[model samples]
Target: MRLISRLNPAEGVGDFWAYIRRPQPYRWPILGLSMLMTGTLLFWVLQERYYLPPERPQVTYITTFAPGRTDEEIIASNIANEARKDALAAEQAERDEIRREIYRTFGRAAGMDVEKIEREAAAERAREEAAEKARREALIGESIAEPAE
Candidate 1:
């Protein structure tokens, strides 16, 4: 506060304060200009906030629904009825296929031959996994050592 008072003398009025007390010729014009600007800002704010905007929507969304319809409301109504029809039909078809397969006695059932083949596949997979692990570890070791060097 003292610093600000230093710019204008404590004893006498400053130039700006003096000019404000005894106005110049263009003071009324400046005041009018400020009032005009404030009115313009107020008008713009009222138009934007209080008044309704134009009905200009994006092209993709314009075709989706009517004016009053929202995407969420449409989806919420359709989710339990129309959307589940196709899904339920597909699920029933899958269950029927599984039921038919369980009744059939022609195909190879779960037995020793299947176990033997599975064991061989698992052994092969383990070997491939160990090789891949060794290769990845070697690459990682090389990467780490190169940075240090």
Candidate 2:
């Protein structure tokens, strides 16, 4: 019963409540010091680091046409030149892709027979050229036979 009374809340609850209600004098200073230390550490870390400046953007300008050229002509020439360059680049890329595809497709078997392949390709090209010539000749004959408009 004595050990139970020492452990019970109803027996010592008044003293416990009184101790909790008492004010502690060091609480404000401890809280203030902790806040000051945190602020100082944050300031030191932010100020000691090296920060790089933002990079400037690159700007490109095309060359102006010579004097006496109209605005429309200059614009048209610029558009045409750009189009031609783009088309040439596209064609070169397509040719490179075709060459790569052909090499990949035939690289295994073409190790020793590359010359034979070339010969066959040449013969095929010759046959196509002959057929085109015949077609052109037939067209010329038809034109010659037609009456004058």
Candidate 3:
């Protein structure tokens, strides 16, 4: 406190502020201008909150082949499909992983819960089988109709 008082301005150092203390002719106009500016800023902020738009939704679709085809044929038709998916999933998982590693690479990259991923993959496979079954049924629709005994 003693050190701060030593740095204070002297009693007789009056200058600009002394002359401005009296009610000048322009004081009312200056005060009104300041109030107008403050009100305009508040109005703009309130208007902005009401006028903003909502977020848009994002959607994606992935196409897959029908099942019942030979393993070789299916693999050939979609050679890099599994690899591509694995690579992307692995990359996303790496971003989420806390540890840097070599041996756990596949697990780290595949970030999904093992059981959940397996279930989803199985469901996808079943859908493919169902699609193939429907295709076959459509092809054989009237050809194998029963004859009267």
- Model 3: residues with Cα > 4 Å off, grouped in runs: 1-21, 38-64, 67-149
Write out the backbone clash pairs for model 2: none
Q: lDDT per model, in order?
A: 0.73, 0.81, 0.72
- Per-residue lDDT of 42-110 in model 3, one digit per residue for the tens? 998877445567677676666576646788988776768888888999998987563534424665577
Clashing pairs in 3: 90-109
Say which candidate scores most in TM-score: 2
What TM-score, computed on C-alpha atoms, does each candidate reach? Answer: 0.23, 0.30, 0.24
The 10 consecutive residues of candidate 2 with the worst lDDT sum are: 107-116
Candidate 2 residue lDDT tens string, 89-143: 9999999879956875686565656656667878999999999978987777546
Q: Rank the candidates by lDDT, best first.
A: 2, 1, 3
TM-score of 3: 0.24
